[model samples]
Target chain A: MMKPGTRLKSAVCDAEIMIIKIAESADLSCGGQLMAEAPERTEGDGDRMHGCLIGKRYVNAEETIEVLCVKSGDGSLYYEGQELMTKDTKKLPSSD
Target chain B: MNIALLLQMAAEACPDRCALTHEGRHYTFSELFAAAQRAAHHFLAAEVKFVALMDVSSPAVPIALMGAAMSGVPYAPINYRLSEAQLTPLLDRISPAYLITGSEIVAEDRSGWVVRSSEEFMSVVSEGEISDLAWHDDPSAVAVQLFTSGTTGEPKAALLRHEHLVSYILGSVEFMGADEAEAALVSVPPYHIAGISAVMSNIYACRHIVQLPNFDPQVWLTLCAEQSVTSAFVVPTMLSRIIETLQQGAMATEALSSIKSIAYGGGKMPVPVIEHALALLPQVNFTNAYGLTETSSTITLLDPDDHRAALEQSDGPIRARLGSVGRPLPAVEIEIRDEHGAVLPPLEAGEIYVRGPQVSGEYEGRSVLDEAGWFPTRDAGYVDDEGYLFLSGRADDVIVRGGENISPGEIEDLLHQHSAISDVAAVGVPSEEWGETIALAVVTAAGQSITEDGLREHIRNHLRSSRVPELIQFVNELPYNETGKLLRREVRAWFAAEAA
Candidate 1:
């Protein structure tokens, strides 16, 4: 989904993501397959590129498309074959 | 996405983790989630416009909060400390409501007000079977309505949408990042924004929450030890009292041995109090969170590293950072704007403006964000050359004398550095020569004495004559609200009466 706050599950792996920011019609893929809105899709093929971590955000180089990993799985998230970089968030002390 | 997404994720990932502990009753994540769903059904069945909690912190606070969010109504938490006259109109504003009380206030059948006692609320929340229900996912829907009491008219209802709160949690916290061993002690009242956000953020992080309905410093320390509370959020005054309890040997340092981090805010923290705290609890990581209800919770955080670095330095930028609220969070952008609305450069004092997804600068009917999307925070402050934010005081509280604008916080902070003064407040009194003159209220330490002229000399040594308080009134204590917010408006009213 293009809207912020929309979550998508990986078609290929168990990885789940909630969109923080994204461009319309962007080719967002994970584990070499396009992400889907829900379950009950064809099984994902190809190698399971394992790297995504729970609670980490992956963003494109332009910094426009961002997604937080709500569930981690064996998948390297990508935007048009270029791997999305895991944002290096300086873990500040929880103030709440 | 709805904040319900956070609870859903946590429940799905770790249902067995202890999510909440209140009065010795521990709830797993799944239990909290199920209770939230049941609460949602209760709200949906009641068909209320607002879900109001006229109570202090309890499991009901979170359940009602999430339930309101899931059911697409705003969760309005009213200040339980308000007088009857003050609270009546506020209560009327948010009705037709599901009013839950955790206090002695008797539940009455006001038109459309469905009153539920705290005990009733708890049982009702947890009694029903789980339902596979769908929640509203609209990002723009108002999630929370906090009634912020100003010195003027009635309290203003500040609204926070689902998007704003979710962004704050996602931006500031990692999902399921906490281990099973972690528990946070939250003592800020249920009505305070800190109390609301603390529950949401800790739930998202999968940290066990231990709510103290009433805050007693000894009780707090004892609970910290008993519950193994590794993290906590306290207002500035609470920390001082906690430190006093530790110092008095009423509670040993080992009682707080499990405390790994403590976050303090909601008022101007005196440098001396923080310094003393740091010296006493070297093992604890201290964070200074600075934000308003309008900003969702914290936009800038003085993290543990900043505290450790500042405490070790004698004098420098690092040392001065202890006086600052550190830098803005990575997702937040802060600016200082002059009276004319032009952006001021670093180190120039002006009004603080913030821009971020989490900033919900909206009241019930009006939005405060500028066209460019920056919300002008009424709090007066400046950013250092290195981007550290130093809060002078609230813009409304600034004392204007002659042509210069004076910050009362500056004078009060300087006075706090004096050993004799235990507490202080500076306000503006009407003057003929100048529009307003300074009036200081000083609370000296027990058995300590200081003359007006001596206090004036002490102020003059550190600041200009204009900055010195014109009238010094020694008092036993400064007037502070339950949340440690200094009632400067009341202090100012007292001086105005004297002038009259």
Candidate 2:
């Protein structure tokens, strides 16, 4: 199970994701494959199936889990068998 | 998590983007990250307990900061201006440290300490191959140790844990939010909290940074125009100098047009100076960020929109807002409290207290947090009906005369409005009859002269008679710390010596 602040990567694609939140019993997948620690690698043509854009955040339908795409790839992010959609970035007041 | 995660994430998102520029040299995000990784390995091999940088602004500042994070050590940037005697105790406090120094500010070498010049340190760190160094993810690790500029008392090391700094960045800044071409100019010294926070926030926002080791008005304006700098953070003194430079017509008309935003803090901003700046740079967004070393930089920001409204709109409510520090950041909670610790109502001046994840009241081994986790800022201020915070000044600077507590800030603020008064400071001296009496030190404007009674009459017209200074002394200029905080204690001492 992935948790907030966890750095993960799709075992099937080059997509990188940082988990923002997750559920008690939820499987986070990308390109129809389970997630793995960033250091681990397993190859598949997951990029050809779905695309992940750079600097975009993807959230599940229930909003229970969210991940930011640190690097763009041809893989889509999913959680609990549901594909996540891009979330609109919120403008924050500048502090510096 | 280690604070280095912010840099790592930025490098991953945009490896080719320029992360920093120093003395005409540029380092990409990926290159800086790699250097930090290798430096961490070197730090571990040397077995230093802390990573201390005792140099002016340079590429080594960012590298040392990130390397310290990767090594699970606190990054302490010592003030190079301090004398050997003054630097001894501070260096002793952080023993067994890997010190990186520039040309002539090297401290005495000791056992368990490794010292390297900036050039040597950079060359060594840059020559090695990237190591598979494991960065510690302990949230409780001390990430930064910044010594407070003790204009009033001895300097104390304010501790910021990994969680405190990281939470501050995550809550306040949007990740990868800045446009690719955006760059920020950082002129504050690395030892100040604003300088450290500016670097982290700019990197997290995916923006480039240009560091000015020493502040010069002409150089700053030239850098902004040349580098296409969109944002910058400066102290009130720096802003005042820049404004004065612009008023003298020394800067090109189009020189500062490239700057989109400018944030000023570290001291009280005179109303006149800000008004002048607003009129000069109409297109630039002016922000007043108010924070302390313990609060991870900014707790409240007078935003650019508020600046514009206060300047353009004539309504009393909107215009009065110019003197405020705006509202608290979304992640911060603020409360004004009386001496009894009871919360004060709106418009009632009291001590300003703040609570938040970013608020680290840790000093050395002591934690000053109250039972409810609130940190008393020791600042006197009142929150307006609209929640805007107006700081009166440091709580210790309050003057008690004839049983009435008067904030020097209010008196000084009013004194600044006088056309003949260029700068002013109000203090309380020992009065035989009353507990204390108000004293004013005035700096007249260029070629302008005013008598003691003339200054008193000017103040008497605006404020209550009791609030007027019983004794006024004209001076050339008031003393200020490097970051622009007024040395009120010194002023009080001067008054005492004169009375004797």
Candidate 3:
């Protein structure tokens, strides 16, 4: 479920998936930096792992997983070069 | 002080007479005066410097405006039609203390403080008898600050004084032959100097003002008939649109029969449109007014007699004077000067300079007035032997391509003569080789078509190759500001974008 102000990322065409919490500092990272910061620890229930992965992405956790990555400006996570979750999954207020 | 005193005198002289009407509600002079007094007291309590008005023409406009003046606070009527980006710059510059609006508008966050609703201000004035408040009689005090359309740059606020306002009303009454009993159906927006001047003149003459929220051709026609409006003012663009509406049978001719004088300004009325309007309404008196915001709306008026006389002269003086804006009003002096500020000979085009009591000396933060007290109008025109002024176009609007000067109006006039062309604007676009190149944007007549090659050929046959537009673009409609004046900067931008 999309929560207000939560951040998510995915690359559906690339078959990749990622989720993250939005943070002010995370905004400076380009697509390369975000793709390189995939977390390593993947142990827990689905929801707990989800929160941990999102938190790791927000903090720029530098760990790699065995998934092809594609980059995009929209905050979408990708796995195996395919989008999994998008910025729309998070109910953030429009910057405009 | 004079305007406040005039209102008080008018109220006392004719308490029972209708002073203003808007949206089916009428206010007598006594009631309107009381409302203005109440608003004055409220402003006094707030101790604000300026009252910003944001609405179209309404009965509340005059009351709040006069009330602000009576309390010695300058009133600025901001054009509500301006985009947020445009409005921001003006709000930052003026920083008005209070905003007076009707129910239709939503106050933006940028407006620092606001006094909403004319009814709210009037209610406060009605709560107490503050009619005896001593009037501030400073002639030099800024009575109103009207913003220009900002077609070229950021809008400049033209500060008009109490004396200037009175002069405009008194002079226009004599020129327009307006009397105290005349009721004017006003359709011009309040933000424009012309609109405000029209309302103030009616008040100064102690005539009834029937205010429309905005210019609607159908509503304007109906009101003129229903209210028995004897006099009215509109820009040439509105006149053209009204004529089109009538031709389409959307409006009836009887609705326009009651109007005595229909004054037009803002731009030149094509000879054909003026002739058609005259033929359609023979009973109505038509006048073409020529002035700027800096001149309190109108400085010269080409009356119907001048129009007929110009047509009668076979030498094209009338057609030439159709390009001319007419002679200066009483107490005003106009001169044509060369680049060096030296006076030019008659019939020679140069910068038009105006000096008079009604003319504003300087703009806020900009000294346009020279040491000799003449303000360069930046308009290129010359006076003929008959003492009539003819405008070529704006001096800035003149294009210099390959070291040769070209007036866009000359090209526009030619395009207007084309049977298949409905409307046209010619602009000079930047070029690497020639510095500037001629470009034309045209709107075609209904059910008519023309190829670019054919248009170029047509132009080449009539004018020099250099004068013919190098580029032609067809558009559904030309971009115009709220007052119907072409947006030259916007047109240039559109051409640039298309080229890219």
Candidate 4:
């Protein structure tokens, strides 16, 4: 999660400025594994099952990051803590 | 006989009054009149008859327009936006005896009589003293010939007489309360009827006119603020851009506040946009002007008060009727007629027939008018109980699917409400089963990802199953002709080819 004082740049306009604060974050899940006191001897043991073990489960979470940024004069361009090259500028051929 | 005489009389009455302005240069009525007199002498020397003008909006346009009138020769202003292929056809039709052009647009074939610039025309006129000539006063004499947009077919030249043009200007000035004190900034192309009418109306009122070579949102906003423009006319597209710019804080409201009225037409204005405009700029008045080239400009105007009242009375239903062009202007008669040419009652949709002094009775080389004297507008619309007229797109634009009629405009309006959709056009595609199925060509907003299924579902939520498009094609932008009107046929063909 982005904390307060962390800057975020606008992905669209590439406007760069400082972010005042981070809005919020969400918990995510990967995959679950069975817990045991020690190493398991067999892959499958009827009595060794923690409950009525059907299959391993995992936690999945979606995250959204929000940050406040300073506004620029150009509506087509938006920036966060640090200005990055915009798509419009990159669309042009490089002189070098 | 000659409308030039009237201009000369007005010039004589107010010689020092500001008549035209271009790029900080101002021309008084007398100066403009003298310039026209000079140009007329040159035309006399060349023995030229019909002339064509191809130039941007500047003092030169009015000078050439009036000079041709004074010289007893009709002038045709060609839209510079037209392709050479389209222009060649029109040039062949008119076969103008002489062509007057600016340095910017020089025709390669100089075989015809050509005047390179207004300065050159003036030079020829300055070589000799101003000659006294009799003004032609015949109302039947052609003053200008404007070509149609050719959306239905090949563009036809609509011949307008001096009387018709003058009557339109007089009626518009009276209805809009335009006077000498008003300053107008015109952004539409000079070739269209709206641009021509705006310039002529300002001249009739003897007001200062600020011309923009083209419509740029930033430039338009800047000029409005800088020039302190009081009144102007624009299409809905330009209005949309202006509002978008304002919302983004790209333009200053203080400058925009100087404008008193903005007349918009050339397609329906979405009610949401209208409401946004009123909320943003409460000081300015909005007018929905409705007309065609055949009518020489506005035939009706829906005032801001009527617009607000319509929205207040009904919910979304009244918003649908906001597409109505509004009540006919004074001295203009509007009638809704059935297929048999019989008049229909109020609120019944039918062919709109209009008759007024400003309406053209015939085309240049063809007879499109009926024996009755009223010109069939070829637009399908009806008058409400309040006498407000509502237009439902062009008659030819109606899509017939499974024996049911649908207006592309209605579907397009609904599609615009989608957050991912930026613009859309609905066209009828060939279908073996239904005879014709609804198809949509859509332009998504920048950085927004939208799939055909997503769009179909979005439309389904707002419309009936039958009303939803069978096919949706995503495009970067919709194809438009020179006049900024959607080319539905081309769009449909593009989608068909893509699917193939």
Q: Which number leads on DockQ? A: 1
Judge the docking of candidate 4 as incorrect, acceptable, medium or high.
incorrect
lDDT winner: 1
The models' CA-based lDDT, in order, is 0.87, 0.85, 0.68, 0.66
Error of model 3, residue A75, in angstroms = 86
- Cα lDDT tens digits for candidate 2, B301-396: 889888988987765878988889999888799999999999999999999999998999989989998999999999899998989999999998
Tens digits of lDDT, candidate 1, B149-217:
564446789999999998899888887879999999999998888998999899999999999999999
Better of 2 and 4 by TM-score: 2
List per-model TM-scores for chain B: 0.98, 0.98, 0.94, 0.92
C-alpha RMSD of candidate 1: 2.1
Candidate 1 chain B: minimum summed lDDT over ten consecutive residues — where?
A: B102-111
lDDT of 3 by residue, B209-298 (tens): 888777888888889888888877787788888888888899888887667778888776766677678778878777778888887777
Interface RMSD of 3: 28.4
Q: How high is each candidate's TM-score?
A: 0.95, 0.93, 0.79, 0.78
Q: On a 0 to 1 DockQ scale, where is model 2?
A: 0.42
What residue runs in model 2 are displaced by over 4 Å at the alpha carbon?
Answer: A1-5, A18-27, A38-89, B103-107
Residue B117, candidate 1: C-alpha displacement in angstroms: 1.3
Model 3 has an lDDT value of 0.68
Backbone clashes for every candidate come to: 0, 1, 24, 17
Q: Write the per-residue lDDT of candidate 4 for residues B390-462, one digit (tens) a residue.
A: 8867877777899887878778878777778788889888788888889888898888888888878877888
Instruction: Name model 1 segments beyond 4 Å from true.
Output: A9-15, A26-39, A48-54, A72-85, B103-107, B151-153
Better of 3 and 4 by lDDT: 3
